[model samples]
Target: MQQVKAVVARAKGQPVEVTTINVPDPGPGEAVVKIQACGVCHTDLHYREGGINADFPFLLGHEASGVVEAVGDDVTSVAPGDFVVLNWRAVCGQCRACERGEPQYCFATHNATQKMTLAEGDDAGTELSPALGIGAFAEKTLVAAGQCTKVDPSARPAAVGLLGCGVMAGIGAAINTGAVGRGRSVAVIGCGGVGVAAIAGSALAGASPIIAVDIDAGKLETAKALGATHTVDSSTTDPVEAIKEICAQTYAGAEGADVVIEAVGRPETWKQAFYARDLAGTVVLVGVPTPDMTVPELPLIDVFGRGGALKSSWYGDCLPSRDFPMLVDLYQQGRLDLDAFVTEEIGIDDVEAAFAKMHDGGVLRSVVIL
Candidate 1:
């Protein structure tokens, strides 16, 4: 066993605490990773706010890159000394999804069987639920061997680690889920890290007239820097109408985009995405919604009349094995601006402050550099 400092959310709606936690040696099918850096993601904040579940004393933080310290006896995909990006969805090749040749939708994902517990404190002996099966905001973490996706060690940990979640979600939404193509018009609603990455993806896919919609001008400016051809401040303009005007094709009077991505998880934004796409255009919902939230009532006939795919992109439908290394290569080639996502690097203790900055929309990501 190893004692490491980790961030823990002890109760619903309580502040996360940095404390000692016990990390066990890699058992069969497991691995121990010495975390290099972990990006602070909104999911961690959601876990702390009790939005995800009632699993209290949650071990928060998932988006991470690290060096493999140890591996199980049977592990062959990765070994000690490999630099990897940790992924939550570790595909089990025997699952139905894998048998169907869609490992991206793998039903049986792998996670470490052994639990990490509080080492010594008031909560000692308490088994903690690692956030998204990662619990990476620590000096070291235990995970399934498959969760480790080996990448170029030359890449900056703080920048590339964002691919462990948000960045990958955004890029995959456009490339894998939406299948954005050359000359297609794309609009991404919400200008946060995920949304901006979608803009970058659209750009990489050769999209034109890429429109970014957000309430914050600062975020819109960031989106432009990332690759948005146009931006709409939703606070001052009707986003649906703006997108319609921007993507209008005079031939058929199709006043909407070829693809519209809703990155804000709300009924209002979803409705905008629904109405902002061209005839037979796709709408990809990559944003996470609260359990209490529901889709607003819309005409059922309209759904059929729209005649296009309406899909929810879970983790952007990404297969980590195929995506992680490719994106790292793109980043190294200076094609994908992954570094733009890192607003600052901080110590583990500054997570609470990072959460505050995230709440206020002050930073794209505050990385915890251990």
Candidate 2:
């Protein structure tokens, strides 16, 4: 094991301390990544707050872009020195989902066999829990070689890393699950990192008159910049009514949107998505909610009456090996405005503060440049 500086969250709701941790070299099917940048995400905060699980001394940070430093035996996909975006799903190909030809929903994903550790107290601690199977808050981390999706090195790590998670989720919701097409009237709620990306994706797919809904005006402006054609401030006015008004202008005779996306996971917003779609239109839920959260109680008849699909998108239905490099090239060609996602560059030590800022939705993404 090699000693390296890493951000370690020792306890729940406590600040993460930068401490020395032991990182092991890659074993078979694994690779060591020298992280250049990692974006702070809400799930990391949830992990630290003991909301996701009871795994203590959690090694936080997941969304990251890095360079492969070394590869283990039998690895062929990537080599050392390759710039990449790290993914959680290193599809095993033997899983039921993979056998069914849906590798995007790969049932068996992999992580590093070796665990990183720290000397926290009197003992030399081992088996630190890596968030989303990638502890990117460190200078270096170990992950399954398949997780290392090689991308263009020209694109900024801080910016491209955001695409590994939130951005990809939003884009996939629009392009993949929702099937938003040319001249479609799409509306997205939340206007956060994911929502803006959906708007951008809809634009890229040639969807017309994309409507953005949010509680914050600043976020609405960001949505517009990301390609939203219309904006609705849900804080002052009812979002359901606002969306209907916007959709009326483009989607004539339809009661609601042609494609309504709910990027907010709360029951209230979800209900809005349920009621705010055109007949036979799609509703994609890209936002994640707690286990305690439940959908609104409704009659079984209403479900059948909806006449459309209610789908949840995981990682934007993105197959890391298939999507990452293509998107990286898009960013390099200046077709994808990934640079706009990077609001600020921070140190690993500032992760706790970044978590606090996440609540106000103050930043698109705060990237930790290691």
Candidate 3:
């Protein structure tokens, strides 16, 4: 066992307590990683708020970058001293989804088998539940070897780690899920981390007239810097009308954008994405919504009349083994500006404060440098 300091959410709606925990060595297919940096994302906040689930004393923090410290008896994917990104989707090849050749929908994803405990003296040991089975808020985390996606060693943890979640979600929404391609006019509504990443993905795929929509002016500016060729301030103007004007076609083009991505997970924004795109254009919803929330009702004819696909992207429909390293290479080549996603590098203790800043509408991402 190894004594490690980790950020522990002892209960829902409480400040995470930084305390020492006992992390046992990897067993079977698991591997122990010495975390160097982890990205603070909205999902982590959701986990802490119990919006995601009722898993208590959650060992919070995922979207992390680290080095393999040790391997279990059956481990083969990674070895000690290898730099890797920790991904939640550790696809099981035997699953029906994998057998059907869609590992992205893998029915069985692996996690740590051995428990990491919060030891209170000798007899009072409390087992900690790793957030998304990753809990990278600690100096060390135990995960399945399949969770470790090896990447270029030189990639910055603060930047590359973002690929583990939001960035991957947005990019994959366009590339993998939406199947966006050359010359397509895509509009992303939200202009946050995921939206901007969608813009980047559209640009990467040689898309044109990539429109960015958001209420925040600053985020729109950032979106343009990433790849958006046009900006629509949803608060200032009706995005549907603006997109119709932006991606004007010879036809009514009343439908406006070709591919509309709802990065803002609200009933209103989903409506915008539903209507903003051209007929038969794809709409991908990457934003996460709360339990109390529900998609607004729309006309049934509109659904059939739209003639396009409406899809939800979980982790960008990403298969970590394929996307992580590929994205790292693009970032290294300066094709993807990952560093722009990281607004600041903070300590794990600052996560609670970071959550408060999330609504501040300033920072894109606050990474925790362990």
**Residue runs of model 1 more than 4 Å from their true location after superposition:** 249-252
lDDT of 3 at 265: 92
Inter-residue clash pairs, candidate 2: none
Using lDDT, give the best candidate's number.
Answer: 1
lDDT of 2 by residue, 1-370 (tens): 6788888887888877888888888999999999999999887888889888888888888999999999998899999999999999899999899999999999889988888888566546767999999999999999999889988888889988987788888888999889999978899998888889999889888997798999899999999998999898887888778777778877677778888889988888988887888878788999888899998986788778878889998889989888877777887888888888888999988988998899888898999999
Report, for all candidates in order, the number of backbone clashes.
0, 0, 0
RMSD to the native, candidate 3? 1.6
TM-score of 3: 0.97
Ranked by lDDT, top first: 1, 3, 2
Model 1: per-residue Cα lDDT over 1-370, one tens digit each: 9999999999888888899999999999999999999999999999999999898889999999999999999999999999999998999999999999999999999999999999987769999999999999999999999999999999999999999999999999998999998978899999898999899999988998899999999999999999998999999999999899887742257769889999998999999999999889999999999988999888999899988889999898999999999999999999999999999999999999999999789799999999
Candidate 1: RMSD over Cα atoms?
Answer: 1.0
Summarize candidate 3's per-residue lDDT along 1-370 as a digit string, tens digits: 9998898887788877788888899999999999998988888888888888886878888989999999998888999999999999999999999999999999899998898988664433688889889999999999999999999999998899988888898999989988888878899999888889999999999888889999999999999899888899888899998888888852354457778999989989999888988988888999998878887899999999979889999889999999999999999999888999999999978888888899898999999998
In candidate 1, the residue pairs with backbone N, CA or C atoms under 3 Å apart (3 or more residues apart, or in different chains) clash, namely none
In order, candidate lDDTs are 0.93, 0.88, 0.89
Using TM-score as the yardstick, the better of models 1 and 2 is: 1
- Indicate the residue-level lDDT of 76 in model 1: 97
Query: Which candidate should be chosen as best, given TM-score against the real structure?
Result: 1
